[model samples]
Every structure is written in C-alpha cells, then in structure tokens.
Target: MDESSRRRFLALAGGGGLVAALGCRASGARSELVKPLPDALFIRHGAHNAETRLESLSPGQLVTPNDRFYVRNHGPTPRLSAAGWRLEIHGDAVARPVSLTYDELVTLPSRTITRYLECAGNGRAFFAELLGFAADGDPWRDGAYGVATWTGVPLARLLGLAGLRDGAAWVMPVGLDGDGYARPLPLAKAMMEDTILAYRMNGGPLPMDHGFPARVVVPGWIGAASVKWVGALEVSTREPMVPANTEDYVLLGADYPRPPPVLTTQVIRSAVCMPWPGLLPAGRRTIYGLAWSPFGAIARVEVSLDGGHNFTRVARLIGDDLPVAGTWWQLELEAPPGELSITPRAVDEHGHTQPPLSQQRLNDKGYLFAAPVPHPIRFV
Candidate 1:
C-alpha cells in the first residue's frame, strides 16, 4: 500500500459506484481510476506490488480489457452501495437463514463460464532464480494472467437458496476485503460444478477492481478460493475458516517451513500472451499461449527451440475436452525460419508436465513454471 496509498484507494473506489467486471456481460461502466499509464494495464499493483499488466491491444486478443483487466487486490479497494449490497447464509447446513441483494443476486439463475484468472502468483517471477530474470511475485513479466467472461449466481443456486440440512461440510467465504481473509471450500467444493456468485464481467456491471458488488467464481480452484469483495457465506459443517484457506494452498517442500498437503491435480501450465517478451517477427509466424490444469484439458502445447531441448505439438483445442472437471488450454503455434529462442511447454491429460525456471529453485513448492518462452526472432 504505497504509491500514494494506492492512489488513494483508486480515488475511493473510483467515485463510489464501481462496476465493469470483464467478460460474461451486463453493461455501462466508466470511471477512470488510477491507470498509472503503462499502456493502461495487464494487472497493475497490489500483492507483492502490482504493475505487470500489459497488452492493451493486439496480442492475438480474446477478451481481457475491462480497463485492461488484471487487478487482484486482496485488500484495499472496498467501496460498496450497489444500492446497498448484501448476501448471507447462516452457519451449518442452512435450512433457514438466507439473504441476497444486488439486484437479488443478479436475478438468480445465471451461469457463464470462460474461466482462467490465474495468480497463485502467476509465474511468481519464476521464483526469483536470483534475478537472472524472473523473481518472486509481481516482477510479473508474464502479464499476470487473464481471460474472463464470468457472469454469476450459481454455486448450485446459492446452495439451493439455503436449504441443505444434513451435516454440511464446508463453504466459508467472507470478504469485503477483510484484512484477515477467509476462504474454505469442501462440501464437495461447495457442491461442485460451475461454482459462481459473480455479478457480471466482460459484459458489464462489475469492476471495482474486478469484484464489484460481489465476487466468487471458483472454477478450477487456487485463486485464493475465489473470494473477492464477497459479502459472506458460511453454511458450515465446520471447515474452511481460513488460515490462508488451509495454509497457503499447502503443497510445500521447496525447502521451507511447514508445507505439504497440496493434493495433486493441477500442474501443467503455460503462458506467452502474444509475444510480450516471447519476442517474434520473421516470416509467416504465429504463436499464442494460455494453458491451464487443475487436472484436465490442455493435452498439448509443446514448443521448444534448443532450450528445453526438443519438442513440438500444438493443437489449441478447438474441440474435445471440458467434460466438466475443469482444465483449460488455448493454444496456437507456428514457427519456422531460423534463429529462435522458443519454449512454451505444456501437457496435461493427467500426465502433467510443465516445469522449469530453474525447476522452482529446487523444491520450494510448485511455482509451476512452464518456461521455454524466450523467443527472440528477427529474420528480415
């Protein structure tokens, strides 16, 4: 919280009526708050200090520009009154106790998914390989991740409008930028499938730093349990009460202090959002990247040019996958003409392969680097 207290909290949440959450539709959003000019955005400052947000235009575009989308503020950026928002459900298998506002939770019955909002420290600066390029959190050279189209209200219809009596198991979600954070999920990930409570993004009404009147869209876990300015939701069986939502995504052992409990199922990752530093330009070329996996989809994205040694396979998934267990991939590759430095790497079909950035500095914990993107082409 520097830079003039984050520009006076985005000028007090941009004149107190913020709403323009990207992708997934609604309408009308305009309130220019602190866009400290870097071509406008990629994910600007907050959490290890922002400003890695780039690509304001052509980079093979595909939705990521609701004010250059990518502002993940875990604290400081709360300014409500979407006609006074509210959302609550009681404690333990709620058979009673329900509340909703913000246009009655967006007039219920809504679901629009096009997920991919990464930032488990998206490429944590390749875990600072001691600054040979890539260093811990928000040196964020890789565009802090994007891809939206989220719309809301679904978490199984607001947990079936608070009617689940029979030993609830976990679902704690309390946020309004709470200084101590809270996130808990289980009860089968809040009754699984398309978990959303989002208001509307990329179509309108929601952009108070990407979580306007409300937020939560846990599609494919690990985004700090998808909590952002959300009001409250604790219909517990006693569990997700937060401790960094069960110890900072537990899966430790990169030589640390207390780690391990990160159950497998999300490793193969990739990124190269239209040649930012992946630099390219030489004879009929085409290369795009964005891949994911909490375990599923993204079964191929291997581009190597004398770095990770050898490999080539790109199919971008214009078909097959998404049988509903969440695992994303969106690729496009084309290269041929001498002098290169390419490295994209990705593979998931339960095979999970995408690691390098000095191999996460030898076991500190899955920073999950999908290195091989250092393209420097120029053959004119």
Candidate 2:
C-alpha cells in the first residue's frame, strides 16, 4: 500500500519456483461440446490421467511455452474445428440475432495483447491444512498460471454487430466446450476495453485444449470468465443467466475472512518460476519472482527474505505506464549479503497486498485468501 514501494519479486533460472462449471442443470442439452484431441495433455499428479509439463528457463524470458502452459478443465477438453465454427449472438434480450462465421468475424476487426492466465485454484493443495481434504480439480501446484500473447477480435465489437436491444443487459457465453454450460458477463464487462474473443495464442492458432477455433479471453478475471471452445453467445436480461456462471471461485466459511467485508479485488500475488531444489547453487545469490494485480497496474512489489519479518522494495519496467489486461509487475531481489532469505510480495494501485499463507485461517474451497504465497530459493 505504500506509495513509494514499486517493485515485486524474482530469482532467476537458478532460483525456485512455481475453474468452475455449474451449468449442466436448469436447461436441456442444447448442443454438443466438441471432444479434445486424443493426445492432448493435462496434470494428474502422475496418476488419475493427469499430465504435467516441466518448465526451466534462462534470464529475461517471461513467456511460458505454449505447450507447457497449465491446463485446467472441469470436464474433458472440447475439440473445435476452425473451418466449421461460427459465433452466434441471439436471445430474447437482443434487438436482433446475429451470426458470424469464422472468416466473417476475423475480417470485421481484430487486436492482440500479452497477459497472464491463471486458474483460480492455482495453488489449492497447500490448503491441506483444513480437514485434510485434498484440494479438488487439478490439485494444482504453483505452475497453474502462464502468460501468452493472445490475438483476436474485441467482444465489444461483436456486441455492436448484434445491435443489442434495451433488455440485453448481459451476454451468456456458451461454449462448444461443454454440454449446456454457459458463463454470463454483465453487459458492461462484455463490452469493456480489451475484452477479447480470441482464436490465436502466441502467433499460432490456439491449441486444441485451448479453444482451437475460438475462445473468450477476459484478462485479469478468473479463468471461468474466459471460456474456451466457445460455441454460442446468448444475450439476456436475466441476473443469474446460469447458476454455474454466477458461482464464482470463492473462499467460503471462516478460516479466511473476506476483506473490507467484501472480497472483490484480487490482492497482489507472486511466485518464483525457476530453481528446483536439485539445481540450487548453494551460495549467496539473488532470487526471482513475479507479482500481479487484478485491480489495476501493480505500482509496488515487495520482498521479504525473512518471512514477513522485513520487506524490501525491488525495481521493474513496463509497469506504471498504464493498466493493461492481465496487469502484472516483474521484480528481482539482491538475495541479501549472505544465504539470502526471500519471498515476493505484490501491492497494486488500490493498495491491497498478499497475506502470508502460513498466517491464513483454513477454508473449505481454500481460495483467494490473499495470504502471501512465498516461494523459497537458496543461493549456493
């Protein structure tokens, strides 16, 4: 929250490192969710059909390899064809129904941006502190988040094409991704700046599991809002268009308390993406980590080499310029004078920050506790 602190965390190649769907009900099967490629990958803790990717990198590299980006799916991956897909916008709320074939949508308009996509449950297992119930879903570790360059058309433009009616207050996005499950976006967010309907990632067409033909990328929001393998968009006047769409990833019960009596802005958070235990140099060296904010541009990133006992500010670039989709700030620490102690902290423009995980009370879903998540690294 300090106006003076402006950097987050980082270690290096030698340092350490690091969904929901509720709609299957209240509606009949409207269409089929395309099946993913037979050979697609996933993370399953070496069992339960989960597959994982190991990422190690050099200095100054920020992009997580496309093939290695983490995957979080509620059901099986849906396979969609680029050549045969079309996006339709229609519903009682809309002034007029409109449809766009793949070619038509692309030719109308386009844009591109680089940002991080993180599953809301990126580090659920650590919450094992509560009742010993293993976290569900991918049982994800720190690697469940990744950054990439996404290219596509703006969702706002698409809404304009639909020529929305007065009753059209929101858009319920249903994907060819799963049967009958659709995510709803309030009209404002759906038409906001930078909200994208993407078909490409990192200069290439999206991978099969990532919505091969098309997907919605609502940067800085939880992954649920960015549905993949999209099939249809239904404009609506309803508040809870889909129960699953409204059931967001939330930290329930009392082990964790909602902030300011309202849990909306995601606190700044970071993790070290390099240096496995086997390769630690075993000496004095700097540590690395990444920090981010869902509220706005991260203006201050801090580090505590000794738990939360003390914090030091780090310096970064390409930040404070403006708030962009997937607002993130990168930082590095000097690793201290000797055997450095370290963990990164993120503080956004709104002044919210990450809490220490060790200090957080346990919760049922075990999420967004805002507790600081520290990644440890040693300098050999």
Candidate 3:
C-alpha cells in the first residue's frame, strides 16, 4: 500500500474501536494511527519497514528504548482492543481449557527480565557480501536484534492454572494479525522460568506495533518463537506440524537431509557499531560495538584490524559485567593514516566463538549468519 493509503488504514483501524478496546481514547489525529519511528532508522526491506541503524546502538542504555527497538513484521501491525481480547488456552492436552481477559492476566503474579530478541535471519546480507551467494529473504544487517526489559506473567503459571493434561508436549502460540503466523515450542521451553506473556515493554504498556494487549516473550530463543499479538495458545499431545516449524524456520542445506533441525536458540554473534566506511581523523580511536549469545554471557570480543591478518586485539568489556547473555565491548588503539578493515568475533561463556565468514554453512534460507562481519574505515 502507498504511504497515504497505509496511514488512512491505520487511522481508520485505530479510530474504529481498536483504541477503545485497549482502554484508551482514540485521537482523531494522523499521529494516533501509527507511532513515528526515529528518522535514523533504516528500511532494510519491507513495505512498512522498521529497523535500527547500526550507529543507533551506541550511546544508549542497555535496555533499548521502546520507540527505537527493531520491529520485524510479517504482516501489517494489527490494531487490537484489549477489552475485547481474550487469550484462549485449549487443545486435547489441556485439562481445563480457559479464556483469559487482559485484566485477568495483569492481576496474576508478574516478573521482569532483560533479554535480547534477535531475528534468526539477522545479518543475512553478510552472506552475499562475503561469500558471494545471496540468501533469498530480507537482506538484514546486524540491526535486526534489540535488547529490552519485558514484564509479564510466567507462561507456566497460566498453564498451571489451566491444568496441562498428561502427555502434553508442545505449546503453540498464535497471533491475531495474520493467518498461519503461529509457531510452536516444546513444552519444556514453553514452561521455562523466563517464558512470559508480556503486556508491557520497557516500563509502560506494550506499544501497538510491539504486540499491544499481550505477546509471548521466549528468552534466549529466536524472535519468531515469541509471537506478537498473541491471541490463543494450543497445548498439544504431539509435536506441532505448523509451517513455521515444519518449513520456514528449519535449516536446509546440502549436507542436511530434508527437514533439518528446527531453529531454537539464537547463535552467538557480534558487530562493529562504529567507523562505517568513512573518513576518520588519524590518531587514537576506540572501536565499540554490541555482542550477544543465547548459550550464555559474552565472555570476550576480539577485534581484528586488517581482515584477520597480523594485528588482533581483545576488546575490554564496558559497564557492569552481565551475568546473563548480552553485553557491549570497546577497543582502543592507534590508527595510522590509511584505509582499514575491522572485524569483530565474540566468544560466549560456553566456548562457542563466532565463525569466520568462509566457515559459515550454506543454508537454502540463509537463516543464521553468526560470522564476524567486516566494516571498512579510512583514517585521514
């Protein structure tokens, strides 16, 4: 849809009871239709694109601001009404099927967690730039991930209230925005302590674009596992056969046969946030960036100045050491007058290091690019 038509749709959707459902007065203004994103945000690929610029990561709190957080929408953002919304928990494996309203969910015990949600296809552009074979999907850079403080009730708490029948093995969360946008998770992962039905982001009510009434926040997993605009959940006795699990998110490559292992936890990765192919004053310069891993906390980040050649430096971790999964690092060194290439590699607490670009596996979908990304720079 064109920009004007898109705006009109949003305006109509919001003014037409969607905002009222969420217990808010709908403003008759265009601004109420869609939240304006920051001007520096990049349009990686999409009709209604939402992505963060690499430079935006610097000089920000560890928890990304709600407006600056990256958004990956498979369909247009649905303007939902919380008052009319109900999360239905049902399936053959549920002992007591129940439908929960927004007010009822918020009255339950709540908890907060700071975690990063990263797209499995993040950094897919590096595949073509470095390996010469482009993946068939959104050509994302390193900005497809964002860290946030998510607040909600533990999903296990709700499942317990509903009573899971014996032999329940999978939990499938379905969205309200589009058809077949649901994904399933093993019961074990679904019942994890950090798995929550989040109604709030940062500190306020969840934004419409970020899954207003509620959404599932599956920590340490790929972003797809956390369904936005969550409306219902299906607890099944057998593995879910949804297309998201059986087709899209699974790895497919030459070595792996049909239906390779389904993607779960995000891979360890790092990216250079500064000095992006521009002239810089020759002297002392500090190269800084963000690094994260799903397995554990980032143990170390290595910076290579000349395309993994002779000079390599280990960056110093900044801020309080994160005992969890994500942190930032910075490296200070003298830069002589010349053009240069900078690359960063992160090692997680589990000893999993970022793979070199050449060592990355070739998947039909280009799902995960966990290799060190090279950034060009010129010292004047």
Candidate achieving the largest TM-score: 3
- Provide the overall lDDT of each model, using Cα atoms, as 2-decimal numbers: 0.58, 0.58, 0.78
lDDT of 3 by residue, 243-275 (tens): 778788988878677757899988888887763
- Which predicted model would earn the best lDDT? 3
The residue-level lDDT of candidate 1 at 203 comes to: 79
lDDT (10s digit) by residue, model 1, range 1-380? 22353244334433333232211123323223323335344444543234434334344354566666556565545556677557776675789878777788887778887665655656655556332543334445456556677888777778888888898877767665525255777767767667787888877877766667778878666667778767667776766434564456554564655545643123446655543444455556555455556656667777765655677555354333442222333444455555665566767777777765556443343344455445455433
Worst 10 residues of 2 by lDDT: 6-15
lDDT for each residue of candidate 2 in 234-301, tens digit (9 for 90 to 100): 77787543444324455556554553122223344666545332235553444445556666666766
After aligning candidate 2 to the native by TM-score, how far in Å is the CA of 214 from where it should be? 0.8
Local error of candidate 1 at residue 322 (angstroms):
21
Greater-lDDT candidate between 1 and 2: 1
Model 1: ten consecutive residues of lowest lDDT? 19-28
Q: By TM-score, how accurate is candidate 3?
A: 0.89
